[model samples]
Target: MKKYFNWANIRLVLIVLLLAFLYAFTTKRNENRKLCNTTVEFQDGEQLFITHEMVNKLLIENKRDVSSIRKVALDLNNLENTINQHEMVEKAEVFVSIDGHLKAVVKQKTPVARIFEGSGSYYVDYKGTRMPLSAIHTARVPLVSGGVDNKNKEDLYELFRMIHDDEFLKKNIIGIQVLPSGSLIMKNRNFNYDINFGKTINMEKKFKNYKAFFQKAVQDSSIYNYRIINLKFTQQVVCTK
Candidate 1:
């Protein structure tokens, strides 16, 4: 029994030493391996505004010989931050493999609406975050103009989201304008009539009435019959001929 217990202890100590040696060997091997390749990929089938070449350029700017650099020496968090700071990038994730390969996964911002204020135009992304307009691509979102205050952007964004949710509105509505009296107006793509939306309150009921009235009016009369359609009142749709 004493000899058996001594043998068991020796076996346990040898196993631990073997594990330690393997860990040290792998650690030294990984530290010595240099970065040989880099890959950049975007998620969610989004259009490429920031290309892989651009990301490679950024890496090259930080380190001229990025490919030759040791894997352990690369600052992955700093690289991720650099990519995340880009105007078009929404998120960035960096990974370095033991095989000396660096991979960067990025998510690009998606625009939901475009605001044309004064001479400049910018985009409101899906997160309701403001993003600068891209010269390479123009998003075909709702164009809002006229007297839109920056403070009221969130309110207007809700309206835009509602419009986007409705297929009829998204297909037909071309432009939105905020009047000087704090009322809202929407322009149709097919007709010359103006949709007087009044204030941004009680919009669900207002749009319901407007849609019902539009369906009936289109079947009964010509599209040119009404110059202005008012949907501001509760449970009423007032049209001016």
Candidate 2:
């Protein structure tokens, strides 16, 4: 008894007991608070379920129907239940403000690029994530040809994905020329010029160089006068001079 009750041992025991009590108390309080919470936030255009109207309805339904704050909180928690049913939802959170407003923010799947398959295209984003295409007509997007063969479809989609993400380049990417050998070329609309990218190697550096070269050509007005711009060379770019 005396050994266990030594000053140092006693202090350590008290600290451990306090930590355990704090953990349990905090956990229980949080669980209880979350169990009966209603106010939440949804990020704009991110949530898959529970539209702004449903959220408002929940608030109004409980505001007039429930007198207890606990009941209001639980009603808000129910909002999360509806959002979680969507397979694309990453996570959801609800924010209740002191001024009596609810906000629910949710994370959703982001598709990088889509492939033409079965009249129902398949999309894949930067995270290598795959999803279906939107039920709408798309234009100006490079038509992926030759299909996703055993060669390398991922690279093809990712290449197109990068071009799509860059607004500056996307506008200039008139079309993609995917070869049977997995090579690529970018067409520019500025002067109906064909760019022979060749093998998709050193993409960023090559693309930047391509842009800079085109800019200089546009400045000079002689490069754009050409029918094609070839950047496949190791040291220099070739164009129809």
CA RMSD, predictions in order: 2.7, 7.5
lDDT of 2 by residue, 1-241 (tens): 3544479988899999999999998766654442233444565544333344455444444455332444234555666666644444445665565434446666655554545666566655446655544433233455554457656765666677778788877778766667777667666766677888887667777777777787787787787477778878746778874
lDDT of the structure predicted as candidate 2: 0.61
Give the alpha carbon lDDT tens digit for every residue of 1-241 in model 1.
3544688889999999999999999999999899887888889756556777787766544666776688877778898888888888899898888898888888998776788877898888777888898767777777888776777777888888888778987787778888888798888887889999998899888888878887888798765799999988977888898
List residue ranges in candidate 1 displaced over 4 A: 1-5, 59-66, 216-221
For model 2, what is the alpha-carbon lDDT of residue 71? Answer: 21
TM-score against native, each model: 0.85, 0.57
What residue runs in model 2 are displaced by over 4 Å at the alpha carbon?
A: 1-91, 95-102, 107-111, 135-143, 149-151, 164-167
C-alpha positional error of residue 115 in candidate 2 after TM-score superposition, expressed in Å: 2.0
State each model's CA lDDT, in order: 0.82, 0.61
